[model samples]
Target: MSTTDSAPTCPVHDFNHYAELPYGEKIEFYDRLRDEAPLIRNEFANGHYIVTRYEDILSVYQNAKTFSSSAVTVFNPNPTFKWIPEMLDGDEHRQWRKQLGPLFSPKAVEGLEQKVRERAIEVIESIAVRGSCDFMADFANQYPSFIFLDLMGLPFEDLDTFLHWEDEILHVSGEPEETARRRTAATIAVTEYFRTVIDARRAEPRDDLISKAIEFEIDGEPVTQDDLESFCILMFMAGLDTVSATLGSTFYHLATHPEDRRAIVDDPELIPSAIEEILRAFAIVIPSRKAMADTEIAGCPVKAGDMISLPLNAATRDEAVFDDAKEVQLDRSPNNHIAFGAGPHRCLGSHLARRELRIALEEWHRLIPDYRLASKSAPTEAGGQLGPSGNIFLEWDV
Candidate 1:
């Protein structure tokens, strides 16, 4: 249960989660990792242990004390910036979660269902008659992002700017120093942008999440501007990126698997289950945790301050956990995959995310039920915190 000077060694795998690979190969890589060993030292950017077993990954997530949320990315184990409530743990984390709960509660997301559906419809309708459209650009990314802007009380006109920021902050690729510079620049731009918004909200409160959050207090003291900026940064990245990448993955599945697509188009009721199955099959997030103390995960020795990566895709695809684990069964009952993650730090916006995914599928299929990958172009993807870079172009007969 603890690491020692003479701890057991694990096989080293030069796996880099951030390295670009075909989306399908990413799943295969995880499967290979799981089959190769219980855990292996990922020899990329200050080597970290990657736990490939479902139960073991679950254990690390559930035991937050031993594996802290202080550092969520392995690339920069000690990140210069914090992502608000995400990087917080213990009582502070609980308090922040409590304050933020109502905004993403089931009832709140339910109230937003119509708006979510409307945006999905609007985005799809604009491209439906075109017969050929880049799903990521024309639909997938636009659908969720518009909803996010509306919810945040931000102007829709600034979406292009926001998208640029998202790329710099989340999808920057190049030499290490160049990547760092772009990320830093984007972070500054977002912080400045939010600063203006916060200042405006301070003068006259608005009926948006930002205004609502402006009133949030921790420890009986008002939340600081820096903390609010951090929250905005985190929300900007999460609100804009995660669902889009997921939608890209989902549509890719449908485009390639016509049978599964027809099954859903024939029975719209299956969209929810289909979405769940797709999420399980293409689970993209790879959450990292920093060790708070010496420990061992499934016999893999981990020292204090060591980083551990828990790839959710590996867990969801684990044969030991699920029946027909690798296959995507649209009607999978009691699907208990941790695609949204497990434990206390599980995604707070799961309700909203699921609603978005469901609504997007429902509306898009209702209109453009039959579509396939563009014949002239190929889909593209990248690796990072959120998987899939979103160059998925889908075309349909008008």
Candidate 2:
């Protein structure tokens, strides 16, 4: 239903972000929306408020109590399922974070750097020698999946199966009803798979994240089976996708922009800064929060239970926040962009994500330093809700 005059007099932009769009054009779309208004009542799916500016979005993130994360998706104001720490709030959310924080801490991630690089090198070498390959399928997707499965102590052989489930859940493409059905089925499959793993880990504990998490106690009580499954599901999605999508965007940028690519190749140390800039430029995650009580954001009225869509791309690209926000500067310093998000529900895997991304870039540039788009046309794009779902193909002389 379109907005009626009686409905809050805010700008209404009706567009379904879940609809597939070329990765570059999607970034442009974000810029257009950001410039249109600070707040837009986007009536795309279930109709929700969109906070576009950096300051406004940051305010929403910081004031988590006022803006609860009960429902993180704009399309579903009331999500049927919980995604663990992300969907939890206040002390419960804090407890989950505290319990899981150490695993992804810088030191912990640092310990895995050598292994991460080895995996990256293995994947890159296999493709670099081929001279041409689907970067997403060959390297981006495989590297992260390997790391994640290894981290969780899941069978590396099941990488393909997990990827299939990931596509169904995160990159579902079909009619609206079909999409929902596929998503539901995949979610169940993932939950069932994790439950089995949890049960096994309980009977025979291993030295992996899953086993460690299985033994966690939240709020002085042993974590429930449902909560454990929720954690596993969340980890499965995050562990497999976030870094993969970010890598696709980052590499697409490098493939198209030779100067940025060359700069990183010439000075490997700049890869970390380059990764930050890429993340800022391609801020993909659209975090949603429900209003706990009636509140006003940027002069727009938000009633209690209202779902607000906060696109990190808009926040990162806000002209008022970062100078040349659209440009990807490899040496961008003081890059205080919230690509991983902000506040209590910030991404738990940020440290590990950074390590994986950096190592991937470092190893790839070390081997295949000069590469470009394999085709004149843009690479195929998939899911937009979380980020571009990888189908990017690149090539260079062997």
Candidate 2's C-alpha runs over 4 A off are: 1-9, 382-389
| Sequence-dependent TM-score of model 2 | 0.95
lDDT per residue (tens digit) for residues 1-398 in model 2: 22223135477877766676666776688798889778888776667888889999999999989999878876667777899989999999998889899988998998998899889888888888888887777777889989899989999888888888988887766566778788889999999999999999999999898899877898799999999999899889888888888888888889889998999999999988999998898887878899888788887777888788898999999989899999888898889999999988888888899889999998899999999987743554445533333556788987
lDDT on C-alpha atoms for all candidate structures = 0.83, 0.83
Give the TM-scores of the predictions, in the order they appear.
0.95, 0.95
User: Tens-digit lDDT track for model 1 on 247-269?
Assistant: 98888888989999999999999
Q: Which stretches of candidate 1 lie over 4 Å from their true place?
A: 1-9, 384-389
User: What TM-score quantifies how close candidate 1 is to the native fold?
Assistant: 0.95
